[model samples]
Target: MDKIKVIITDLDGTLLNKEHQISDYSKKIFKELYDRNYLIIVATGRHHLDAMPLVAGFDFPIYLVTSNGARIHNPNKELLFSFDIESDAIKSVLDLEIDPEFTTVLFKEDVWQTNKTNEKLNKFQKELNYRPEVVNFKNETDLKAIKMFFTHESHGKLIELRDKILVNHDHLFSHAFSLPYCLEFMDKSVDKSVAISKILEIENVRFDNAVSFGDGYNDEKMLTATAHGYIMGNAPESLKKKLPQLQIIDTNEFDGVAKFLAASFLDADVLKN
Candidate 1:
């Protein structure tokens, strides 16, 4: 066989439609791409459980890099690689002055915690498909943390909280917003690029042969690191500015990722361009 070509993509606002559902066009394109022996890896800031359903019905050899690279797994649920976050580091982060009602979801063994109200968090847990244990901090036992998430509403307020945390945790951690109302935390070295490089190494594909797409600040690193990157139109201005040279494709609302792949590899008949 020749070299393996790979395309890594982010989920929301990059692969999924406005309704958070994968479109038929995308599904067909993915089928074609998988049939052609191209590797499709989903690199997202979502937890594994959340990402699993993103490609639920697709029968293809797909890989996943989740939690901003804190964990990597194959489509078959085989653990390829992972990085653990120190419990002490997590405790220090939780010590910040941020609101406790927002709660924190840790990926270490799939642990979740909150001291404030449970109404909002219970709804969140249902969306994520996990019934997190409710603890009062005094009864909590396991502290081993892999990833941390904070759910909030205001982007400006989240950024402010992020900045305050950064002051004390600078260079000690990495952060990303999986959603406008979410803040994802990982170790400093954990990011899509690091995970992509590792995947490339494992698959023996050169970095130059990889193509990636994303639409958020967490995606900026992978988009910048890859030889060719397609930024979704909905990407934040700060993220777009990070790669001033790359081309910006249509918004995820238009199936930007599937459209790009069809144009680049699939036969011309598959795309209207």
Candidate 2:
């Protein structure tokens, strides 16, 4: 295989391991890939703020495509591009009939919001290390929200909500759970494929020269769009069943993305196969 000029990767279950941390081997390989002038792009369902920790203190000036494709940020956290949601739409979203099994989170700029929070929401707060402003359904607050998240114990219910949201709001973007317990949202155009295509245009790279990795329903369009897309072996059965044609790589626990990088761009023998 010839050199892939850019490598785009999803965060939660593709680049990040079971522990939700980038392994040392992966980080080392990333450095090597960057050193060789390969542009490493963080393409994920996460927001720009959620992406910062994984990239902090890294030597290279990596680019971030977050909120699906609603936001594009450089290593320095500069907003190279962004998309917004109207305040009324955000409020209307809160008014939707939310399943008690699912907790809805409102992302107003950088802060998160919830109505009558529960333990699950509290857990996420602890994980994120930030407390969101709690409000009753009656309270009115002026906040510029860009995204919303929903978490549910039932995968089926989550799927139902995802589909219903998209059906009801043609203008809104509704994505499947990036993890087993969540659903994320932004503008309908805010997907990794669209974001990466935009980035490719800005960077003057061809779609055929780009590669990407992902393991969820949200990643389907992105994988199909890229010239070379690797689906992690640990990807959900639904994804694997849908994308049998793409190459399947090992799990992130094994530094799967990096291993592919080393073989495809670094090792000569494997390149021949």
Candidate 3:
């Protein structure tokens, strides 16, 4: 009900449609809001190298919270803030013994690394693209892991692995399913809401006055941090069931976020028949 001071959204399932690109309408809406002096920030479970290019066309100041808030970069691409797993914790996760069905992915320093090439990866494009660095994890050491990941098809199986890993290591790291096929591990303190609040504080804005949108378990804190939070219709059933109180927007494929923004701030009845 308070005048919205900032617009923050998650990438993949919230802003980007099924084709993994921001719709023209979405871009236009954000541009209009930008012209009105609203700060637009994108918070994603993606690495900066993987997330930054998608919003490069914004042509305005936009902050990026990457690796599920393990790191943040300003519009100028400067490292605004960062949090990494301690060396010991990184070692423990690296030594994790588990099913080979899951592929490993991680971000270290300025690079995105993987044990092998997996075609299912959304960012794996054949054109001039940001490719993952393929290196056998066995040969890598002393890695200051910003975030580590495992991708597979079975959400239930991933939960099993997640719980098993957390049995002893939960204190060292936090885990979340960015996508049904992807489970991510970051430093225990890493959170998108925390990172967003830091940005808001620097911008001298109120947390309760922020407007946020997201569609995953990783986004729970982010959605709860603001008085206005929306969940995408395409979110996992479990996520919806977990937070049924959050308003449900249309599917991303239909530009749900854009429509909501237009209706809310622009005084447009996009969702009205």
Candidate 4:
């Protein structure tokens, strides 16, 4: 235990339960830590606008690492830092001759836009509680996109597309899968760990004094970057295999994050029920 000073976590499948919301139990633990002066940060692949609403009820100042580490926002949604994908890169992606089966969404500072809509897109929108504006990219100019997301029903197909993109523009972009069906792209230097490192530097905290929890491939770098990283037991076995050194804890559905924090920092067993 290096005296944890900061807590970094993913939103979707780590801190959030099956309903895509933080449990009351987790909320209480988070508030307790916030009151004690521990920095609480949410590092996610989600856009800041979408991510902020989920944690809106928390009264304390929480930081956000959004757009898969491309942007960092303060509690008030002010842009503290950002890295945008070049217009050329966005153009290259848009110019690609891809299958109509996959739907692509482009994320700007204020809104996400997509020309095509499908069942998968609708389902994703429902999860976020926000809908993207339908727009044709050809008419859009000076597009400073923070991220690009591609979704399909087949994981194998998504991997193939990811490989194709890498082969063509590996130097211009970095890629990760937030979900099996979702392929996300950002600047070459972006990753959750990058954001975490920046936050540590800003707070004057040692790397060893940070703890992170996550359950997706996108979280791999963040987990490895910290001394105390825990993967939820509900995570896919493949992700678990990749980080065998980190501890395994109960699933998000079981309030694994809350239980671990309570036991480790609060010195009390919240799971004694």
Most accurate candidate by TM-score: 3
174-198: candidate 3 lDDT, tens digit per residue: 8888889889998889999989988
What are the lDDT scores of the predictions, listed in order?
A: 0.78, 0.75, 0.83, 0.83
Clashes (candidate 1): 0
Clashing pairs in 4: none
TM-scores, one per candidate: 0.88, 0.88, 0.93, 0.92
Candidate 1's displacement at residue 148, Å, is: 0.9
Which order, best to worst by lDDT? 4, 3, 1, 2
RMSD (Å) of each candidate, 1 decimal: 3.1, 3.3, 2.1, 2.1
* TM-score of candidate 1 relative to the true fold: 0.88
Give me the runs in candidate 1 sitting further than 4 Å from their true place.
1-4, 101-103, 114-128, 137-139
Which structure is stronger by TM-score: 2 or 3?
Answer: 3
Write one digit per residue (lDDT tens) for candidate 1, span 62-139.
Answer: 889988898899767898888878877777776664576465566655645555544654543225654466566545
Which candidate would rank higher by TM-score, 1 or 3?
Answer: 3
**Candidate 2 Cα errors over 4 Å, as ranges:** 116-131, 268-273
Q: Please, what are the lDDT tens digits per residue for candidate 4 over residues 4-54? A: 888988987788888777888888889988988888989999888777777
